[model samples]
Target chain A: MYGKKVKLRIFFFSIIFLAILLTTFLILKSLEENVVYFISPSDVKVLPELSKKKIRIGGMVKKDSIETNAKEILFIITDYKSEIKVSFSGSIPNLFAEEKGVVAEGFLKDRNYFTAKKILAKHDENYMPPEVKKALESKK
Target chain B: MFNIFSPSKIFSITSRATKYVFAIFILIISVGLIEALFLSPKDYIQSDSVRIMYVHVPAAWISLGIFSLIALLSISILIFKNKTFSLIAKSLAPSGFIFSIIALVTGSIWGKPTWGTWWAWDARITSMLILGLFYLMYIVAWRVISPNNANKVTSIIAIIGVVNIPVIKFSVDWWSTLHQPSSINILSKSTIHHSMLVPLIIMTAAFALFSLLIFLMKYNTELIKIKNKGLDRL
Candidate 1:
């Protein structure tokens, strides 16, 4: 009787254990739908489907391309080969400058313009990405 | 006179009592989810995105909490040869990993529109990445090591890795960089509104309880496994 009780307890707990794992996996998979992505300027150009979706385009803000009107700033974002225009009506951070990597979050109304709600600089001196460097060099 | 509640017995009440405990856990978690999801008013600045706070913050807390628990338990097992302690440490690991992943994923969702970047390598974020990596390594270690050899080896790793937790946590503020300082806690300037705060509190409490209950159940299973296999001596 004692042995049977022990076996039953193990059986019950194992079911619970498997249930916990299954629930976690299902929740995680559902959450996966919301995970968004950031695309390079070049990557954005090729994927026609993404043109209608809310997306982020990240690259350097071209020097001399930034224009301002009533504290709202307008600038051109580039992946070296193609340029996308971004306009933002907010105070710019100190790191926000031309020739630095910036990710502009908004949607493309057309293929050429990107209206931005937020902008952030990709700043990490030690962790310079190889691809961005390659992109820069190819332009030269 | 010598019932299940005897001094030596360990909460071995009738199965009906255990059912009640399960019901209480379910009730608390349900209330917590509702409060976190519906009752809490949006942040004045962040609005609905801030709702992510309910799930993200508690998961992050549990991730760190479990790491500490594992580190402490590892220490106890090493210093005292306390078999129960090592078992507890091992049992708590997956819960920690789950919450850590939750924190990372929820953080990304909250950041998508707000931060403008899906992910960043800022101090808090990078350290969090490391924390997540450490979690993976810890799990892999359990799988790779022999059962008899696992305890002492993992203990050393756990103790050494504890230092990284503080580094991951403090790196953001120290750098004067991006990624805002801890919100929903000491560094935040604005107080959370009562409606949102209530659910935040409830969900956090529920998450902690869930983690605890899971830990207990897992711990019990490990004990049984060891006993059945006569590996308790190892």
Candidate 2:
């Protein structure tokens, strides 16, 4: 009976192990199942016949060329190699300035501007304190 | 055989000391975070989000460090059948899992402000998630296997599974993704000033010590279980 009890204890723990693994799987699948991988115009060298899948493009806002309409805001991003125009319909970030490194996610409707659902700013590697960050913000 | 204060007691003595160590660690972490967040000088550009570095970088560092320690603990058990080593591995698993959780949560919080979206399937995050899952499995392995065989089986798994850690680190560079490479690892071009790096280093050290303290406490509990088993046999 003692041996049996020990074995029973181990069996119960095995179920716990399965439960944690299942939880991890559910969480990761939820995170990845929806994200669309897009590419930049300069990086979009292949220009594959991608018509069905959604994608994202990343680069910089071309200098002094941001155009805004009531419907959309359009700008070009460059990887220092080539540039691609991106049209975003959402509230653009203040840091989404001209000639800074950026990454945007969305689908391309034409060769002109890729419609962006999301835009990300790639700053320097380190985090700055708020006062210094405010200084930079004030300059902008 | 159970000499409470024998030479074997060094391990036990250190286990008790971990509580003091961890308390001091928490103090250091809070001081470091406070300095970095409110008191320290800010960046030339990024304002508030720059403060995310205090939390994000340390959590990320701990996630990987825990796994490497697990591998080391596992190897010591498998190769030498070291009893204390297995105890250490079992205790380390939950903390590693916690650190991974911290890294993911802090990263997501940082992401919302900088990336516009709350989440991204970037290379580094993906690998970090995988590392977290691996940690869960390692802990589960410890719980399921027989105490005797758990040591052997988990040790083997830890040694074999370590291959994934490096793969997770380099996956960003290998595959094009939104996540960038090691910030400090890059030359002085991307270097953070000493003022910023000091707080980060202190936080990292504090976190490591804190994890070790928890590990010692956990080990003491498991040692009790082992001692009880011997009593049962008698």
Candidate 3:
């Protein structure tokens, strides 16, 4: 029931669609190398290797562990069970506080040390996204 | 299925529904705003900044949902050669684009307080930005291209753009991003406390009602335009 013109048009559009898909695939493949993986302080302790690639670590800032110096701020991030020391030399976000959840993007200097390139102050500790809260509860 | 109604009948039905939809939208918004802004308890961590979720999440959801609907309708258009499908797609684009922009703007506002920056190239944000761009492209195709060919071309874009839906949905799991993962799961009970979830759910319903009201009005206008074209041909 279809006309020859419609068939020709479909074929023509198919070629264009394939070209777009191929371009998107290539770009994502290249970007995959640069994407950072997020981990908790506890996850870092169990890593098989000291990854040189940048990664993100998220956890609550340990109370009483924050210290400030002339050009740097130091804090300890804890998953309650494990803690890792973090140091940064940049202006911190206003929301950054002790006992608050935060995610830091940086390279792991060693098993015990993390030098954060940027600090992401997470929302209220009670504000666990439903998905995250569910995931956390499921793990428990 | 939609063809069962004459153009005049469609207009009358939509006009009658508009009153109830508008009232519902108003009721929901008033309740949602009060709950979101004043009644809901401040997040233990993010504080009041968590309120932005009421608007931001719904806008993002509507944008994605509209595009997916357009894609589905486009499939019907190709299969059935129905003009009504294209017209409905046309009707949905402006609001879709508007909600997409709102989502981005609200997201940036929300991000500034929590993420330490207004914008980041995180996977979720990047993919959402692309989604907004695709919405603009779809809208532009309808406006600038001739009517004869616009339906075919825009439908093609809609279908192809479906690829981004899964990407946006899975971005949090697929990449490490500053944006938090989706919380309101459909498969299971939401982890959000009932007090907060009530307002969020209400706001989502309000937004959906508003979208439907806009869509109905636009659909009526489109049908009139098509009728005019028929008259001109005769």
Predicted model with the maximum lDDT: 3
Candidate 1 chain B minimal-lDDT segment of 10 residues: B1-10
Question: Once superposed on the true structure, which residue ranges of model 1 sit more than 4 Å away at CA?
Answer: A1-118, A121-140, B1-21, B185-191, B231-234
Query: Residue by residue across A46-126, what tens digits does model 3's lDDT show?
Result: 998997988889889999999999989999999998989999989788779888778888989998999999998865314
Q: Residues A1-140, candidate 2, lDDT per residue (tens digit)? A: 33565566457545744565566456545754233233667656557565545677776678987898999888888777877778888876545777776787787777555778877865435454555556767999
Q: Per-residue lDDT of B1-234 in model 3, one digit per residue for the tens?
A: 555545666666876787788888899889889988888877645667889988998889999999999988886677556776787898998888888899999999988877788987778888899999998899899989998889988988898887788888888877766677777778875557677788888888888888988988888788777677785310
lDDT of 1 by residue, B6-99 (tens): 3113323322244555677799989887776676555533546677878987888889888978988776566556665676688788888889
How do these models rank on DockQ, best leading? 3, 2, 1
Model 3 lDDT, residue A83, Cα: 88
Cα deviation at B176, candidate 3, in Å, is: 1.4
> Runs in model 3 with CA error above 4 Å?
A1-30, A37-65, A76-85, A94-101, A105-117, A123-140, B5-8, B230-234
For model 2, chain A alone compared with the true chain A gives a TM-score of: 0.57
Query: Where is model 2 chain A poorest over a 10-residue stretch in terms of lDDT?
Result: A31-40
lDDT of 1 by residue, A1-140 (tens): 33565566547545754665566447535743332225666766776564566677777889899899986889999979988888888755545777876777788876777888778864432211234445657999
The TM-scores that each candidate's chain B achieves against the reference are 0.86, 0.87, 0.93
Sorted by lDDT (best first), the order is 3, 2, 1
Distance from true location, Cα of A119 in model 3, Å: 1.7
Local error of candidate 2 at residue B31 (angstroms): 2.7
Better of 2 and 3 by lDDT: 3
TM-score of structure candidate 1:
0.60
Question: Which scores higher on lDDT, 1 or 2?
Answer: 2
